[model samples]
Target chain A: MTGGRLAVRKTYKLFIGGAFPRSESGRTLELEGYNVARASRKDAREAVVAARKAFGGWSAATAYNRGQVLYRLAETMETRAGAFAAACTGRREVARAIDRVVWYAGWADKLAQVLGSANPVAGPYFNFTIPEPTGVVAIIAPTEPALDGLVARLAPAVVGGNAVIILASDDHPLAAIELAEAVATSDVPGGVVNVLTGLRSELAPVLAAHMDVNAIDVTGADGDVAALEVLAAENVKRVVRAREDRSPWEIASFMELKTVWHPIGR
Target chain B: MTDLQKRGDRSPVPTDWTYAPAPESTDIVRLQERYGLYVGGEWLETKDQFTTIAPRDESPLAEVGQASEADVQNAVAAAREAFKSWSKLPATERAKYLFRIARILAERSREFAVLESLNGGKPIKESRDVDLPLAAAHFFYYAGWADKLEYAYPNRSPKPLGVAGQIIPWNFPLLMLAWKIAPALACGNTVVLKPAETTPLTALLFADVCRQAEVPPGVVNIVTGDGSTGAHLVRSEGIGKVAFTGSTEVGKAIQRELAGRDISLTLELGGKAANIVFEDCALDQAVEGIVNGIYFNQGHVCCAGSRLLVQESIHDQLVRKLKRRMSTLRVGDPLDKNTDVGAINSKAQLDRITELVQAGTDEGAELYQPPCRLPEKGWWFAPTVFTNVAQSHRIAQEEIFGPVLSVLTFRTPDEAVEKANNTMYGLSAGIWTEKGSRILWMADRLRAGVVWGNTFNRFDPASPFGGYKESGFGREGGRHGLEAYLRFE
Candidate 1:
């Protein structure tokens, strides 16, 4: 190691179609005084294409399997907490990030319980209710607390089995790229989570109004909330408004409900 | 014959200056106090009655049965009673009813359009074309969801809310009805519907259509009246859920009334949607969106793009194009074939529009109007636009609900998004851009419920639509639309 600092390795790239590559537009931006990867509009479109390819199978995953995968992700994230924390600007954020992963992992099984309930419906046929995830969520990670907030926002969505296209915060994106590496090495299937780091003013609307993005999370978005809300409406994507005081446990807010109805036949 | 006698002999002086179309015996659905509130397969009546008027000339159209507090209670009771069986029906069977309703509406399209125009004061072309077709498509689209609720709410049973009390607005009477009723019915909930008092004709006609479609009685009840009637329906102890589409003021009132009640409510209220035109946008397309945004349906649209935010670089050129396009808009009798804008829905509404337009001028925003004539007897307001409008002006902030546009300009993309989102309402917005990157970027920042790119006010049944923030909550279309009518268990 040079000067007692860990020898840095690997240049992060855009995650698309189960492979990592420099953006098709061949664009890169300087982050933290280093030439880090930046995604192009084409790369964003490719992420969408990959998300579309993965949506059906991923969304079709059984709740139990989804729960298991989420749990596994939490386990993997726990082991790599030091790396994630080191990537972030501080240590408090890393702890919160790990806590967020655990919190969301637990919700994989419990969300259906909270958002779904047995309907005391009027008719004789047995009726029950559940919540379902809106597919292929496109997330604009909160600009601050790049790693923890992003993890908190994205974990619940994926725990609920939503494929995601996350546009990492433009200013501090290394953490996001690192998080993507963590996801890649984990058992999480490719295309289930895509990370694009670029100017949000450049990529958000594409994700928001994208015909394919089923929902969007602007939890970290600061300004122009109304414009993003409107753009997501083009395809009627379910939008999660940004919350300034959101905590790690709040990840459960993104979980989809699924209600199951079984007849009480004698 | 003498000269005077010859003049009299000339077609007897065409006695009735107003055009009179033949009245159809089959189409008339009589309004009466004893009319059964259609709920759960039964017709029940309330003790009260309210008069519905023709906005065309402010004449009494009919005395519609007002839902009593008890009537609301009874209707909700029936709906709740029916929800078990109805909600249990396979999504496919539920969709069949919606599909049938869509077909029936289409088959009776002409009759519905005429009655809609007569009741709501919208132009015949709009009623016949935009409103009716979209209404039919809404039902048809939701009908597909009857079986697909599984897919819609995957891994979960999407149960129906027991009883939904839906109130529709007068602007797009039939279409609003479809927006509320189609989704509710498809989601397998019984509904007590209150059509805006001024526009009850098409809804009553719809009841008849429901009867024809063999939609079991009590599944959908039509209670026609004014705010009092709507308020009573909303406050009734029986309703499990409430959905209202109208002015934001009234939406807040409904919310207040239901505040302590154990009911889920969705309000599709007002919007001052911003239609932003960038310097590089296709000028002709942006101009078309501008006209559609403000002039469509005489600007009574809640999500109408009333605030025109153009880039400063293209402001002059865009305004010139907009003015030229406005000149071509034909404003006249709703019955006329060439009319683009129709009469204001009612006298009160017209007065409000006129008052706001005057305020725009009084505030020093320069007003421009295309040369157009207004009908003397009915409520009418010419298509109007105000330039040099400050972002802080009342005219720019408030929803005028008439064919009025407020013009403001911004210099940068950040400024455009800032100006576009500076509103209490977040219903819908429009962005005109040829650059694909910018389109996506801008869309992500807008907080409105829907964003139209390259087009304005283009609504489809397959797409979900609704507002964010005070523009109201809950969506009205698509798979996402089902959530409004369904319950999560």
Candidate 2:
């Protein structure tokens, strides 16, 4: 058996509805002698459905519960640190990606306090501005620092209570697939975070034009952000274009500021 | 319940309840021949003109200037010119101007309230109690924020975006103007605001408020017009930001027009808000919320709860109670202090509501109207409710923008969320449940920007307001509101 020298290769399948499934069209692309499922508009469509289905449950989770779930994601990612390190450009990037997840996990419970307000209106009323998740955010993940960039875009949206359907980096796909593996093992609910890897061009437009999608994060659309923004405007989807700072405001950009007024009385 | 019962034989008969004629006097509001555009702290000359007629009685209130292209250009230029001094002023000084405006509005509150009811066709009680007070509160709220922008959004310095172009709707005309102008002024941005053609008087009166407060020249300008004039101002030169509160159709059009432009836009548009009544709700209060949700402003509110989703267990009881509560609502003259529901804002809006109500009837839904008499001449729609309304019915799907509620039943919490968020518009929603956990769950699931736990149609100045989806974007009212008019470094 030792002399047989059998070969075992990894199959990079798209993650949807918490299941690793091959492309519906059975399309494949070979990058550096690796077989990767080529995600189609249909796959993006399926991810959006899954994300939308998961949105109600995931967004309804208490902030503390969500924070714990996201922190669990960081723990799972740490256990698979070696795998992520092998797939990514460096061990430092994977380590930083884990740290970034921890960063967002901490923000899950605290960001609301930072972003929300108890407004003082001149009336017999209790007024509040609470940041709520804009549902089913479709994100186009960044190319450079594949593992870290992908984590940066994914964390804030989910931390703020949105379900995400992200198009993984077209140039560097292996790290994203590894990250998806860690996500499946984490406490994140099925369909809460769906990762599809393939042609960004074919998928981004469909996601942008998707009526079910409430927002589009074109932070990694490369040159297609302007076009995607216009398409998003067709359905009035909130468009968060590529920007550097991953501040709390980045999460606020994907969140709806809901101001509630209740009459002050017994 | 209290209003009618206090009068005597608290029988639920609609014919028995006759409200005393408590008409608010309109003698206080003085009108001009042709009110030209307010630009650079003065009335600018304009050739084009149109008459602003009262929707309650169809009498000409004033001959308002129809802003020409040149007039739009002048307004933008004036705002741009003032932006220099406005942005350079100290935050405390800026706060003073807003405080002055708020105080002036309060001192002359009754006059403004009367003008608002006459021009917008809202009940005098609402104009006085809701619109006028909220308008003053908006300016007052923003005035405090003017000097404290640094504390509002921690860890950042907020810089004012120059020369905002604002356009408001006919519903709560003065209130919408306050929502638009107050925040922009607080953030140190000079504004060129356009009031809706149907109701420009209160805003033109606001221009007078600016003068009385001695706000610097060109700091605030009011350009009156229909949609075309609004279009010109939107595309006008030197407009760095645009804020509009109107119908979603116009909001999307404006979004398309402003796409890829550097200008930032905040749209407060239409809604088909779902008023969800779960099994455990306080049924009587739920009935009151249902009536207030749809019948308020004659259902002209963008955040109005027009879709009623009652739990199947409470369906019959809730509908019966809602119908009874609606029957008590007095609908007639806008100036009448006793009126609960008033005339439709325009003939076009009234016709639209009529056509949609007809579609509901055609779609096999049961229609109910209280046997109340509307004023003889003006545009009016009775407080209407459709029972057995399918989620796909036209009345359920469209924003009729009049006093109409579509009643549908849901058996489960999941189904209720599904039906509530079924509309393309997600402006506001109401959840009526006594359970603490369920309210949190429902508020989480409901897609609306503003979710009322047990109340409906409640608004406050400090409370940021807007929508989630096709109901439009950006917020106006709190710290989030200032971001619409400020550029962050």
Candidate 3:
């Protein structure tokens, strides 16, 4: 009975606020012989709404708490690394992607000390600077090394207390949906890491112009980054054009420096 | 009567106390009849020129050149050429140039201060005490870092980004120029700087100081113009980094213009800051903090505490005290050392402040401006306070970059935090409380970049200053400021 039975195919859909829902437009793009959810501008907007809703609690969470959740995310990805490998390019890439997530996971609590400083400001004042999240960040995930590039960009942003709405790699979006499945099953909260599989040209501009979105990482942005930058300027959004490297500075790029001063008085 | 004023402490005033005239002599600054653009270490003239007036008396100070696209291009090319040598100079040599500039600025501080107050309409006290000293201190602070770049950022080699294009605001003209030029120069980058149209004198004066310091040609170029000139400098092909300090509107425009270009940018934009007063706070000290927070420099500060959030229990007492203190603030000739509030920067700025104040009154809030008379001819706005202001009021929400303060009441710390952050801008916030734990708590919760606890409007060269949201990005002071001018290898 088992030998003749047909295997059911997976219906890839958009991950919005942690839920695997089909795109509101009910559109799909054929890629690698699979139907992937083709997200609309409205879908990108909804993702931002969800991300904004999650921001207050997530950003307020202690760095230690954020670190723990990110660590759990790595563990969840490791368990499903085989599936991730099958969806993306290869096993080496999936392994690197999962390892990169763990690397960023460790930086969640340590970024403040490395990136922030206490100032000996020449006054009777105690001054210190700390890095705070830049709120909802929109990540344009890269195409090649799909899983690794997305994790490299996504982990740093999320680790620093920012909620993300990622426009997954347009060509290799299956890996993104698969990663979203792992995110849903992990300790990461809903709306924390939203995945939209669609045309970068269609979706990137909407996210760039969204007023609620505080920062953008265009590491994966393809063609006319200037146009996207122009849209990002409407809100004075922090535009990060970073390389695909795993560093605390990548996390710092999405964090704002907040310096507090108090007079040392009796 | 408004709700809180009914219960406000209405103390009687004595009539006899008044300060004697103490005007700083304007004879110290001998202004030239005409000034040209400082390009490639030379004063070059342009056919297009505009007269810069002293806002204090609307007297034309000097005719300064208006930089055209060609002028801007020439400036950029000069800066680009200079970058080859400047960026290659030994870091120690760079440090020496900066140290010399700092010393010369300190030596000529009074002349620069007089010109700053005369041109920018800031009080002599601020231009003399706050602006000049801080401007000199910024160069001194970044000067030490020039030779010590490796110690600033570990593991990464910090190198200068070439040909920084800097645009500064009318407020604190010399100080903003110092902020822009010091770090760029300390990092071994050549710069083409555009000072604000109304207050280009100090910058052009500082150009003379650059010459005295024997800085190489093309190392620092001063192009004086309005926004169009700034736009040209931002879009120029040779610039590797752009740093601006002004309105959020212009910052966004610059960001859009530089979009897709492989150039770095840092913006010190606008702020609508909140100064929160707790019930248990030291009442007299809090009053002083509130007055200094918004009234300092005529509230032209990017981090001005324009919104005052008071505990509902002490709203009456605090507002009454604040008004009493604000009344004593002399708003008169900027040259008068006794003047606390000074002239508005320009007619356009005065119109903006007037329109916003009118909007506050029309929206049914109570407005209070003390019984001090403004001088007849010049642009002036009195130290203003608005009560019964809702969080949504235009006065409370917008960056009224003048001596205007909008006071809103909050019943709890959470409510105070909620209302404090309910703006598109988050440049700075202030907390007035005796309790140490509460100050830390409020500081943690406030979304602004700079938070002053039990004190307000305090800046130091070592303290990093910038904003969180639309108030713009990157810091201007301290170790973090180095990151903006440096490229990592």
The best candidate in terms of lDDT: 3
> For all the predictions, what are the DockQ values?
0.03, 0.51, 0.85
TM-scores of the candidates are 0.66, 0.92, 0.96
lDDT of 2 by residue, B1-489 (tens): 324334366654443555567788889998787798999998986787899999988988888998988899998999899999999999999999999999999999999999999988999999999998889989999999999998876767788989999999999899999999999999999999999999999999998999899999999999998899999988887899989889877887887777667788888889999999999988999899999999999999988989999999989888888778888888899898889998899999988998999999999999999898877998899999999999889999999999999999999999999899898988999989887678777776777888888888888776778898898889887778889988787
lDDT of 3 by residue, A84-187 (tens): 98888889998899888888889988988999999998888899999999999999988878898888888999999999999988788988888899899988
Residue-level lDDT tens digits of model 3 in B103-155: 99999999998999999999999999999899999999999999999999878
For each candidate, the alpha-carbon lDDT, in order, equals 0.75, 0.88, 0.91
Q: Which sections of candidate 1 miss by over 4 Å?
A: A1-266, B1-46, B260-262
Clashing pairs in 2: none
Q: Residue B257 deviation, candidate 1, in Å?
A: 3.8
- lDDT score for candidate 3 against the true structure: 0.91
Reference contacts recovered by each candidate, as fractions? 0.00, 0.70, 0.91
Per-residue CA lDDT of model 1 for B38-136, tens digit only, reads: 555655555776666666566676666776666666767776776777777776777888889999999988888777877787888888888899899
**Candidate numbers, best DockQ first, in rank order:** 3, 2, 1
Error of 3 at B296 (Å): 1.0
Measured with C-alpha atoms, the lDDT of residue B474 in candidate 2 is 94
Sorted by lDDT, highest first, which candidate order results? 3, 2, 1
